[model samples]
Target: MLIPAHFEDLPFDPQRPRAPRRQLRLESEGSTASGETARVLIHNISTTGLLIESAVTLAQDERIELALPEVGNTAAHVVWMSESFYGCRFETPLPASALGTLELFSRVISKAAPSESADTLPVRIARLRKEQGLTLEALAALVNVSKPTVWAWEQGKTRPTPERIAALAKLLGVNEDELLSGRDGNALAQALNQARQVVAEAFGVDPARVKVSIEL
Candidate 1:
């Protein structure tokens, strides 16, 4: 039987709590000692370590270098493994500045797990805009709309007309159907639910009584 483990359950000194991990989906590149590179998917990250999934064969205790966006190459060693997923501890914990950059990148690119939420229109718009390195103002200028209007569309406060959506799709390099479908709302909902559960467990309260809210 496969036993599930939480990061908090890992062996550690009781006085020093392990760093919290944030869920994210980021495509990154990793290379082994022999300099063979492979594409890897980052599932979650913390300053101290990361959980990654890759098809490249990796053994426990193997050292690898990961090319992190904005963070440059980081060295890590495999601490544990289950199938294609590997838990790696960084040789040096990420500095605060690098952690900030990684967090920003995560917020920009992290997608909801397919089982948790289908990619929504708002999610797609926000993701594509960030991926293209276009600010709201820049995208608005290209779409001939006010910056707030673009923000409203991304926040699901308002939606563009079919004509505007078609224009947006073209600008975003996707088709109309791809732009209009999939919702980001469910991703937020899932995160909120997870938060509530965690808080409830910490306080020994019912999840229903734990209200969670996120600003932006």
Candidate 2:
């Protein structure tokens, strides 16, 4: 086994509480069968499963291999995906011991239960704009852009450039990260899974049945 030479031992702090459960953003950058490098964000993951949101579409039951920096590598089955995102369940469980090494590189690592909020950039922009009490026209005036541009931002059909993001942050009195990336990929996956269960229960069927037949 190759031990990461950079991992350092820190005195455990009881009060710190194992940090929050580190959330991982799954990213895929490889050529698909059609020969295009598909980039995707891995929304959520456990030892047994992973939720991915990618630009490329994957059919259910399609088998694919994944390159994980932490867990070495593995294969997965496409359990679900939309035009822009997909969820996958691993074919096998990752070794528990690997979690420790993974924590070192993860963006969000802690012990808390994974949050289940569904975050989308457009929804976040709309919510923050409303919270700040900035009218679309007012925001447009502040950004020196047209009102229609602001509308497109809220609708999520397009993304603002770095300069536009800076302007939006200035108008909303928030940071760039807040204005740009409010949605947590992991949280969104949990919400999707929960919602799927609730709907399945209401309809008196297994969740798997619903997924197999549901049209993307």
Candidate 3:
């Protein structure tokens, strides 16, 4: 889980440490003044700015509007660029609540199955549904999907979208991590590596320069 930390006190001071940021993988859409919308992959986010990758060409200082979930359209300007990746500064910093929502959405979107899971994702979803005393129809209603869709998910014929996964995890009273990766400890190492890579790319530095330490 991501803790919402304030970034109001921190400015863009090169002499001081950067504001706290969270690594995430969120698929969202953005539009430029040309009214062309493109899919964007959000790599990480902070109150002040974010790192994103897209196939669409964006020049430095170019303004774009992102269709962020729950937060609606957010305006930002490109601050730097590296190949397909772009570092952007938000026109207005996100609030703590908005940051929390984005973090939750990111977790739901970026989950990967553990390599040695005892059960497959479909089996785990079915088991969790049963454990929650929910029928197929009941779960479908709760997740705002059709019964056939829920059945398909359980049958492994189809997978839920990231938004639906978030809703399903909440309805089943499970963390997104637990639902997707079975809460494997190895996931922590993977998460750290991903974080380091995101930070390194955002700053245009070597990944080795970005060290992550956990207090607990």
**Winning model by TM-score:** 3
Compared with the true structure, the alpha-carbon lDDT of candidate 3 equals 0.67
User: What TM-score does each of the candidates earn?
Assistant: 0.35, 0.35, 0.36
For residues 1-216, write the lDDT of model 3, one tens digit per residue: 211111111224464343222222233222223333344556578888887656667777866665555777677888988655678999998776777777665555344423235577777788899999999999988887777668667756468888988888888777777778766546777999999999999999999999998885
Each prediction's whole-model lDDT (CA): 0.65, 0.58, 0.67
Q: Tell me which of candidates 1 and 2 scores higher on lDDT.
A: 1
Could you tell me the lDDT of residue 74 within candidate 1? 72
Regions of candidate 3 where Cα sits further than 4 Å from its true position: 1-37, 113-216
Candidate 2's residue-wise lDDT over 1-216, tens digit each? 111111112345476465321122232221233333444444356678766545455677765565556665576777765444456778888877765655443443322323325466666767778888889888878888766567667755357789988878777766777667763456656777887798899999887765533344
Select the stronger candidate by TM-score from 1 and 3. Answer: 3
Clashing pairs in 2: 19-110, 19-111, 20-110, 20-111, 21-110, 22-108, 22-109, 22-110, 26-42, 81-86
Candidate order, lDDT descending: 3, 1, 2
| Deviation of model 1 at 178, angstroms | 29
By summed lDDT, the worst window of 10 consecutive residues in model 3 runs over: 1-10
Error of 1 at 23 (Å): 22
